[model samples]
Target: ARAYRMEWPADMTVFEIDQPQVIEFKATTLAGLGAAPRAELCTVPIDLRQDWPKALLDAGLDRNRPIAWIAEGLFGYLPPAAQDRLLDNVTALSAHGSRLACEAVPDMSQVDHDQAREMMRRVTAKWREHGFDFEFADLGYEGERADVASYLDNLGWRTVGKPMSRLLADNGLAAIPQSNDSVSVADTVYYSATLSK
Candidate 1:
């Protein structure tokens, strides 16, 4: 929303898609602010676990036009099959010049899932002590997911992968501190890609 408010080009439309509950919360919060959202901003409310592409199309997305897609902090939450399905849908909808930027998780098979889950539980409990009520372990899918870079490569997308530490340093930001379950915080990657002609 802030990006749409501050940086979206006038000629381009921006669609923000999320679960219905999240969308409802955002809508209500924006309404309380008493200011109209940008004309180019379209909020599409649908569960990604369902028929989200149809809902997106119904919300005025143009499949024929090129789009820049971002999936920051999202894929990790979905099951491996759901992740693949999302990519399939995006590929189906994308036009020739479509591009994507996403944050990629490391190979879950290489991580200690039990340790990671316990660490997250501890963090969540600490937060709950301060009034936040949410199960952190419920927020992510931990298993052997497909490699995002490999998947995109197989689809003929030109992709570049960078470590999160490099990305942060390039942007002059500090790297994330190491934690007990370093696999959860370390080894994250980022990818930028363009569809093949």
Candidate 2:
């Protein structure tokens, strides 16, 4: 960047990408609270399933520089193909040395459908009482899917994955109860990776 005379900001610009409605709501709420972020924050409103890489570039992301990407609580919300596309997009946009961290949910087909449905029923019922009723099962895709870590590994990312329970125990925290139930997240795997030069 210095060689090219790119006028990148002294402070790193953190981009937060999400749905248009979500971005709007967040902006409104933040304005209402007079909240301020410590760093330069750019909120990009675009559907992840669409041409988000272009949208992000338009929002001033510097692909020439290393980007630390986080896919927190994101993949399960998308269909398997969309999830794969998202990963591809991220990998394509990243420069060498760019790092990524994501929380990977198990393949939905491996989960207990009946148990998941019952759990969602109880949770959605409570939301309906509060006038915010929506079916996640309808929004979130469910079926067999490729493992995130393996997929990224094939794309040339040096990867490391650990279960949430293992992370907790390593941090000296009490472990969450392990279960085969869909609602239990103790076994959720988190992956961190870097694209090497």
Best of the candidates, TM-score = 1
Model 2 poorest 10 in a row by lDDT? 1-10
**Cα-based lDDT at residue 144, candidate 2:** 79
* Residue 3 C-alpha lDDT in model 1: 41
Residue 159 error, candidate 2, Å: 1.0
Model 2: how far is 8 from its true place, Å? 15
**How far is 62's C-alpha from truth in model 1 (Å)?**
1.4
Per-candidate TM equals 0.91, 0.87
Which stretches of candidate 2 lie above 4 Å from their native place? 1-10, 126-131, 178-183
* Residue lDDT tens for model 2, 83-186: 88988889999999999999987656666788898777777888889998697557667777789988999988999999888999999999896655565777
Give the lDDT of residue 98 in candidate 2: 98
